[model samples]
Target: WDGVSPDRNFTGIENYTQLFTRPELFRVFFVSFYYLAASAVQIVIALYFATVLSFDLRLRNLFKGILFFPYLINGVAIGFVFLYFFQDGGTLDSILSWFGVGGDHAWLGDPESANTSLAGVSVWRFTGLNFVLFLGAIQSIPGELYEAAQLDGASRWQQFRHIIAPSIKPVVSLSVILAISGSLAVFEIPYIMTGGATDTSTFVIQTVKLAFQFNKTGLASACAVVLLLIILLVTWIQRRIVPDDKVDLV
Candidate 1:
């Protein structure tokens, strides 16, 4: 049924079929890959920072607040801020100009680089949350373990590999699940920044457009359901592969 029509039509599986058959479906999922890659980088950066800051560091709390501040900002506000940032001759361009790079390039207008630019924003905003998670997990490890490892003349890397990593396996697993799910459901950033234009349309943004912009409520609902099932399947597969066994930190 069209979104505006009150007449209810029962078209069983038709919406699903249409959704799956569209050529745009492949592109939509492909766009999600950029964010997925960004999420991986975000995790690594977060973990690195978390590990470093968990130990003694100068003004660590201030640094943590600076990193996490982006996550706390309103999405709309961040979107507008980045719009200015990526616009030609904008802040990013000015900074790059210092290194002999030209400021004439359009960061968000080029289809080739649009998704990458948007994904970078995602990494900037979400890394803080992941950092906090890793930091907490690392801090919770028994201090005695580190002391024992140091007594054995274990290097920093050895202490991390043997103690920190094993103790934080659960948080790492959780971060992976969240990253995958969040990557698939990315909406607000691309929606507000690019309006899903320039090949930056994500699955969630496409669904919103189908429902509201195209008046394809039935199809949009099907897309939403499919997204949910996809997320559930991914979570199930991840759980099966990474069993939730208790990590013995001995």
Candidate 2:
């Protein structure tokens, strides 16, 4: 859409068709799937932590601040932190070395480990967001609900299974949708870590590569359009599954 004047033809589906035909697309799609899956795992872990923290516990503010610190920092900075940790002579590698388990390895550089390494960064950086979302949902639940459940002789786990699970379904669904969309568009972290390596390149990264590196604006536009549709479809499905309360409120 930039610097094209009126000279270029609008090829419509041709560009989109090329997205499937292109070889580089494999890495793009894989990276997107990897990101989404890793993000889901992170969100689940955060929600669990949030649930625990929701109890009347000491040092709650301290715990919350620690959990959210990563998100407050630059994602690229966090990526570099993980990069150093994954690199040889870094903290994690030193820990591994101490255990007599494994030696120094460039986790972000290797093909097999690159995606995992970046996914770990993505997960850690955004875990705070999921934690807050879950915490909000947890606090919104009525105290009377828990009291009534206790009167019914409900155990903590059972109360969580019945009350918390049902009450937070919408929040869970929304988080899942957001994670999928946001992770699919991953760029900065991977770019900073591995420069869109084939094993870790995401759709958004490939879109930039296609447009700038290969001068394939048509294909890049197509990829972007496809990504948008995928996000919209997922969002629509989430809304359908979790029924928008806005309509009810209206």
Candidate 3:
């Protein structure tokens, strides 16, 4: 955790070269699929609720508070809570049993399900932030546009497609950026819930393990740098694809 240790001293470039030669390096990317899945789910949920439910201020506030509450809770605590929820005969299993499924299934114990469970938790926790962002974007659309659309006998779906979506293109782009970066950097939930076990290990968790657990700070630094570059590269690519909305002042 500190640069002061003599044993942790090593060249990051060399560490990078050495680390990539190992076969387990690809496992990091494999586990990172969870992030991709969670981000997509979050975006869809955020948009749906923002568009369909934003008009009901009282109900919207209630739902927002409930959904956003998870984000307010400490990451470590969230991990613990979900860990118990997914444990054998725990809340999740109880609910599943009600639906006549998940009989004797160990959600976190199974390599196949562990990362997925973590990803679902990620969506549950972070979707609320995006919901608010989309909600604000929706609210900012001028009432006149909706009124005009209404006069034209435009359906709600058409109004959303033509007016709401175009007006909030910038916010959507911003949400995509945040979602991708946040997903790539995910660490705490997986760390506390699974301890990088059962193939639920992520890039950030691996970096932490290399640094603190193995005292390979240089290699860990290399991993951190690689992850940072991946995020930057992906963000750059996203921006290129969905350039920011430009306003004409002239």
Best candidate (score: TM-score): 1
Report the Cα lDDT for candidate 3.
Answer: 0.83
Query: Which ranges of candidate 2 are over 4 A from the true structure?
Result: 1-6, 241-250
Q: Give a tens-digit lDDT track for model 3, residues 51-170.
A: 987665567677867866777888898999999998888998899888888576788998878888999999989988888889888887778888898999999899988888888888
Candidate 2, 1-250: lDDT as tens digits: 4335567877768876777777767446766767787888888899888888988899998999999888899877877777678777688888987889676777766766888778878888889999999999989888888889899999989988988877787788888888978977888888876777647777888889888887777778888888899889988987887784521111
lDDT score for residue 82 of model 3: 92
TM-score of 2: 0.89
| Candidate with better lDDT, 1 vs 2 | 1
Sort by TM-score, best first.
1, 3, 2
List lDDT for all candidates, in order: 0.91, 0.80, 0.83
Name the lDDT value of residue 119 in candidate 1. 95
**Which rank order by lDDT, best down to worst?**
1, 3, 2
Which model is ahead, 1 or 3, in terms of TM-score? 1
lDDT of 1 by residue, 1-250 (tens): 7777889899999988887788876468888899999999999999999988988889999999998998999988999999889988899999998999874788898776899999999999999999999999999998999899899999988988888888899999999999999999999988998999898999999988888988888998999999999999999999999987798865
Alpha-carbon RMSD of each model: 1.1, 3.0, 2.5
Model 1, TM vs. native: 0.97
For candidate 1, the per-residue lDDT at 38 reads 97
Candidate 3 Cα RMSD after full superposition onto the native fold (Å): 2.5
